[model samples]
Target: MLVFILNAGSSSLKYQLMNPIIKKVFASGICERIGIDGVLKHEYSEDKELKLDIAMPTHKEAIEAVLSTLTSGEGKVIDSINDIEAIGHRAVHGGEEFSASILVNDRVIETMKKLIPLAPLHNPANILGMEICQELMPGKPNVAVFDTAFHQTMPDYAYMYALPYDQYTKHGIRKYGFHGTSHFFVSNEARQMLDRKHNTRIIVCHLGNGSSVSAVHDGKCIDTSMGLTPVQGLMMGTRSGDVGAGALQYMMHQENMTIEEALDIMNKKSGILGISGKSSDLREVLEGMQNGDERCRLAVDMVAYNIKKYVGSYVAALDGVDALCFTGGIGENAALIREKVCAGLDAMGLVLDPVKNNKRSKVARDIATNGSASRIFVIPTNEEYVIANDTFKVVTESR
Candidate 1:
């Protein structure tokens, strides 16, 4: 089935028109700066793409532009927009309400609205995209594949914070891990590489600008690095992961800043950017490190150390790991980062082969050597594929 996958951010909307069954992308692009001046970048084929400056004041106009381009211009991939069978919207926070992907309807929309407080930066845009799609293509099937859905299997003890019980009951405050789809996809792929064994312990390190690690036991997520939000786990590009509450409070008092101001710093000014006092992009940090910048080197060490600590804790949580998999942009490309994460874990059965780790490949490949106790792999994540496949399944079954 041809599925349209939509992931709407605050000012950007990304989408892919693809066939879920065949694992083929018909076309894909992103609409940038929705509330400001708009730019539509459409990739119609492997070698051809079009970037046009357009005026899109809202998500509605963005979708319209996408549909118009897809059927009538240089970006055309299909005869008509109607050829797209289903729409899959990436909902960021389900907040304990949805454990699986479901066809979008009034109730699902309302539930997502209630979850906005949990994911203020994500759910609103997601809902806007879904509502706009529904309005544009009336009666068309829309499925919401939530980022939090796959982590719902986490036990209450694993997700609950040690705050007042009423805080959770009345305010819905808890550790709702993000990046569930990526964790689920990569872990399952790692399992398949491990001969489709049962009772397998897999640790997935999804290292990107925003990173997270998950402990998947027997194909289910038992624990993850991210907690409550994307900023709670491993050090990310800008997010200050797992900082002490008292430290933030003390800094706020010293600086006489508002709660929002302090949180903004943690979310947007910390991590590699805050530490190195350099660019947020990891590539830039690496460049500075090679040039003998101590701050940049420190930033690299901090990120690697945080990820290593999380991996160790999750290994204990899963008792023992059978496979350790890396995915996402940084995890897939940064050989130095991967080597640092697994540098001293030979006893834990994660012996990294420098040759295999450095070589680039599009397909899944293992980096652990023959003498290693467990397997270590670099598996590229496919959250869009999961979204498209789920949308196809729900829509097909509904009929």
Candidate 2:
């Protein structure tokens, strides 16, 4: 089936056209800086890419631009928007309402809106994408694949907080982990590679700008680093992950900042950027570290140390980890970070082969030494594939 997958952010929309059944990509690209001036980067063919400066005043114009390019413009891959069989939206928060992908309907849309409070930065954009797709592609089946769905399997103790029981029952305040799709995809790949598909214990490190660590046991999420929001896990590009509430309160009092202002600071101006006094991108941090920049070095060290601590805790959570798999942008390409994360872990049975770690590859492969008890692998995440597959399934099963 031809699936058009959309991951809409506040200011950007990432899309992919693919056929999951055949494992083929038709076209994929991103519409960046929506609501401001826009840049449309489209990859229609494997080797040919296009970057167009276009006016995308809103997501409506953005979608229209995408549709135009997909059908008739220079980057055309399909004959028309009709050529796409279905649309899949990357819904950021499903809360506890959905445990799996579902065909988009009135109820689904309404529930997604209800989840806006949980994922204020993402849910609205996600809903916009879905509603716009439904408007523009009137007859097509739209599926919602949630980032929180797969993590729904987390046990109560693993997901619940120590907060008042009434708080949870009243407002659903608990750890509904994000990055479920990536963790699900990569951990399954690890399971197959390790040939422990049925009774597997895998730790997935999704180290992107928004990073997360998850413990998957027996193909279900036992626990994940991200809590009710994406801000609770491993340190991220701009998010101050796992920060103390007391620190936030102290800062708010000293600065006389509102909750929103405090959150904006934590979510937008914190993390590696806050630490290094530089860019949020790890590439920059690594470059600075190479130049003996103290804060940048400290930032990198902190990230690695945090990842190592999470891996240690998760290994204990699963009783024993069969494999520790890294995915996402940083996880796949940042060799030095990987090495630092795995350093001094020989006692825990996780050992990285330096040469293998440094070697660059697009495919998933093990980096653990032969003597290591648990396999260590670098598995590139394919979140769109999971979205497309689920979209295909939900649409197929519906018919």
| For model 2, the run of ten residues with the poorest summed lDDT | 194-203
For candidate 1, the C-alpha RMSD (Å) to the true structure equals 0.8
lDDT of each residue in 1-399, candidate 1, tens digit only: 889999999999999998989999988999999989999999988778999999999989999999998899788889987898899999999988999999999999999999898889999999999999999998889999999888888888898999999999999888888899999899889888998769899999999989999899989988888887788998999999999999999999999999999989999999999999998899999999999999999999999999999999988999998999999999999999999999999988889999999999988999999889999999999999999999999999999
- What lDDT score is found at residue 398 in candidate 2? 98
Leading candidate by lDDT: 2
> Whole-model lDDT, candidate 1?
0.92
- Compared with the true structure, all predictions reach lDDT values of 0.92, 0.93
Q: In candidate 2, what are the lDDT values of residues 195-276, reduced to their tens digit?
A: 8768889999999899999999989999999998888988999999999899999999999999999999989999999999
> Number of clashing pairs, model 2?
0
lDDT of 1 at 292: 100
- How many angstroms is residue 96 displaced in model 2 relative to the true structure, after the best TM-score fit? 0.2
Candidate 2 residue runs with Cα over 4 Å from true position: none
Q: In every candidate, how many clashes are there?
A: 0, 0
